[model samples]
Target: MIRRSILFCLMIVFAVSLCACHKENPDPSGQNPDSSPTPTTPDTVTIAPVISGGGINLVAKLIYTVDASTAKVVRSTVMVRDDTDITPALVIDCIVESLKDESLNLSFDGIEYSDGVCVVDFDDSIFTIAGKSADLEDAILDCIAQSVLDNVDGCMKIIYRIHNEAYSTVNRHFAYDFVYMDD
Candidate 1:
């Protein structure tokens, strides 16, 4: 009985102290006393693909969120199977897959990067699905080029291959060529 009484008293004291700790310790500026960290949303987000890369490396590809000033890289965690072929098309496909978000609205069939040239191959039917708007084309190309320039080393230019022919960036609204060095 005595032991139980002491335990009950201790618990009461603990509760009282805890309650006192939460008393109004307000700043002079008169903000809320119960201050907490504010939640902020990220700009770039990468989604996990349904066909996962079942391999050792967690981050198998990278995407990019671009603006006039800088390009922010968003990495993707794709684990490829051990015996899978790491082809040029596969690498660029992984890159494009990781970059599907609200900012850029489109998809591609295949991609290749070599000797400072990035080739994005898409079926001509993409226009039928997404419409024939010049703005969409510019945004899609800009997003693709930004992702390639940020992730692929020596990727100085991008070629949009629609009719099996390499096509360069004709509009030139954004600065896509980034592979330059002073050696």
Candidate 2:
């Protein structure tokens, strides 16, 4: 009877130990019975910059109106960020040099920012150039496009004009759709 009692006690102790072990081991599926806040992943957080309303510059006087029969002339001014490290002026000068002797002239009227787009307008003389070769014409457009791409990160598009007329077509080199190639 003593031996049988000892065996029963040992069995009970073993069963108790097994139950304790099961309690210590957590569920593999991670569905814990305890209700607590789970730690969040760090990658889910996003931070953005704060923009003020008065930061934009406008140049309303530089704009000129075009006649209804003629192509529309749109003038936009873009501000070069005072903090930007890039040299946009140098790029513009390079483009001007590339149009050497082509009678193409580009002027930096001023810098202005409106809405989210930066507008950089050139004088009407930029389009008044004459006697340009096919290659020179392409280079002129490329120069302007590249300048904007290289200098301005905020600018997604550029509008080209000659004497305030929409630069829709070129005479000898390409079609009016030449500006679309920048895409």
lDDT of each: 0.51, 0.45
- Model 2 residue 146 distance off true place after TM-score fit, in angstroms: 1.4
- Can you tell me which runs of candidate 1 are displaced by over 4 Å? 1-57, 60-62, 65-91, 95-110, 129-132, 166-183
- Give lDDT tens digits, candidate 2, residues 23-106: 554777767778788876442233333584444332111112212122222232233334444434444554455344233455
Which residue segments of model 2 deviate by more than 4 Å? 1-90, 97-130, 168-183
Q: List, residue by residue over 124-152, the lDDT tens digit for candidate 1.
A: 54454235445545545555566556555
Report lDDT (Cα) of residue 37, candidate 2: 88
Q: Report residue 45 deviation for candidate 2 (angstroms).
A: 37
TM-score against native, each model: 0.41, 0.35
User: What TM-score does candidate 2 reach?
Assistant: 0.35
Q: Residue 59 CA error for candidate 2 (Å)?
A: 29
